[model samples]
Target: MDVHVVSKTDNNTHATFSLPTPTSPLAGPSSLRIRPSLLSLTSNNLTYALLGNQLKWWDAYPVPSNAPTPYNDASAWGIVPAWGFGTVLESTIESIAPGTKLWGYWPASGHVVDLALKHEPDEPSTHWIEVSPHRQTLLALYNRYLISTSDDETRHAWEASVRPVWQCAYVLSAYVFTPDPASNPAIHPYPGIPSVKETWTSADADLSRAVVISLAASSKTARAVAHNFTLRPTSGGPLGLLQVTSAPGPIQSAATALKPHFATRAVDYTSLDTEEVAQWIAALKPAKILVIDFGSRDGGFEAAHKLVSQDEVLAKAEFVTVNIGYQQKVYTMSDVGAALASAAEHSKIQFNTSPVIEAILPVQGATKLFAGLEKAWDHWLENREAAAPDLQLVWGEGVVGEKGIEGAWTRLTRGEVKPEEALVFRI
Candidate 1:
């Protein structure tokens, strides 16, 4: 088994592990072999590393360590978790067969892994659980895998690369808009007047004219949310879609093509200030506002916090906030401390700092999260072709790919990868 490992002490570097060949698997359900094909390394994965120990991300998939190597650091040898496609090579379970492709979470380090399997009642997707005991306490979503459908292989690869982030985006859409905010039990907790039959309150004039502001607008997840909003306009849609992006070029390109249908106006991060954002909110007077920040760098948090905290902005329109991504890597103890302190300062703004909160809504659990994403998934399946061109697929193979993974990590740590390109490795 050949696998990759990031230095426990350094976020910018990684090490690859090549293990001894395993004996043929003719054993029980506990014995299985899988060849991982594609890995989607986006900002979302970076968040796993940033909060790995704190959140138990490292425990999701244990990486086998080879002795006398740079990766020998016990604490650092843990593999980061990733969502991708893998093909079954050997399985003792009668339900699974060699060459069968499955999509779900996997260890980031190696090309191959042997895991325990627990079958679920057969369904349209032939569901099953990867019962890796170390991951038992983690989110059930991470443990579940669906038998990959026999579809266009390229399309499967693309979907595998993007689905993890989409899961977060989709669930978010359902939380805020689905079942109409007025009737949703979750909406009752918020201060604003709840809408009875719409996403926002029909009784509150401001709620009817609500606007959804997507920070880090260039991200596929954020764009997907904006796109989903257009598809499921059960609440008469928002007054407008406002995209806050540091690099407006790619988003502008996308917006140009999606205009009039998924119409959005891109606001440059550098030039936009709290006062300006306040003006945008105030302009939509008598309407509530929701700002979902998918950004993690260059004052992304500070600027967003300030905008939503303004008296003028909140006077006529209440502000709601949710965070989804961390484009910036928090590497060291100092970095962690600084972020904690910074978060404390922004606490005054009352933003939902974690996706888990909004995603699970009204509570925190995996089953509810998955249930909420079904509609968004349906919409994406029908409209994937139109959205494919905006994605950049970079292929990495074998030893070169191993080296490429390290390079990609370094670039991502520095926020060098362009917002338009998503890194997908073909190992």
Candidate 2:
């Protein structure tokens, strides 16, 4: 399951990703006991960790105060397995065959299965039911709940289809993006005055501005977030349009569907002479940018910085940067990214770079929340459109299921899940 190790299963993988592991909490590998019969998934549940495992890295316990980075100066550290997620639309699910495609797990592997309802009070409303599981699960724990005309019928349907993986990016955005600066109920303040847009749209400020989702063409979460965004129109302005890619050849039809207000501005970043992103940002003055920057080194931080420093494009609006997080290596990567992202409202030093972490709800202490996420996933599925309680944990893994990409000891070091090379056939 880790990047360095190989599995005996047919899923020969070579993919690499970051992981979070805390030095404290309990160090090193855990011996998991299998109990697949206990697995159940529901559309109603929402919070969950992989198979009842605490999915984050390091001692990301309730922040004693609001200290954002304790690992900033550590020479070496341990990492824990992290996770990623994608949206599994009914249509997309219906269209693709098993093993044909996969969305990132916000950074965790929990997305490998789908969610279902359970009677266990301590568990998430839903749990996993693997029809053709890649790895035989032992003591699997799932979260998320769904509504069916008949409970039995719904249960049957859940058993049939593959459970959706980790947290969907759009759903995660909805949860993490605290659009309203005025209403950001912080145990400790994040600094600066609230923004006008966030203040007016406090209840929906996070929902107010239309997000310009990158990698829109293929990403399930990108498309899902777009769908979710369109359903909830905010006053932030017409959902702005911007798409950038490196893949070549004829444009796919998905590009055209995103038209008019939803403009798909495509370009090849590989051949650019100088930080060419400035032109793109200037052309479409995005209010607050939410990007799904996979494949790249630093959430496009290098390119964006080049543009902002050399060109005047990024100066016009309040810019919020979300990393492909798949690129996150250090604690500062995510910490600073969120700092700059929420900077407009929180007002700190104008950092030209950083990743964002917007928790969907107020989470309990890390351990407790991880302990009871399967039911939480159920609660989430029931109200996909609704915002859950907002807990404040400023760690990198806090958003969606992305925290799964940590090291062996905790997320702090350098360990991670290695996707099966076989997935390349589908990705």
Best by TM-score: 1
Candidate 1 residue-wise lDDT, 216-260, digit = tens:
887878877766666545445566677888666666565555443
In model 1, the worst 10-residue window by lDDT is: 188-197
| Candidate 1 residue runs with Cα over 4 Å from true position | 24-27, 65-67, 122-124, 176-209, 234-236, 256-263, 274-279, 307-315, 348-375, 381-389, 399-403
- lDDT on C-alpha atoms for all candidate structures: 0.62, 0.29
Model 1 reaches what TM-score against the true structure? Answer: 0.82
* TM-score of each prediction: 0.82, 0.39
**Clashes per model (N, Cα, C within 3 A):** 7, 119
Cα displacement (Å) at residue 280, model 2: 4.6
**In terms of TM-score, how similar is model 2 to the real structure?**
0.39
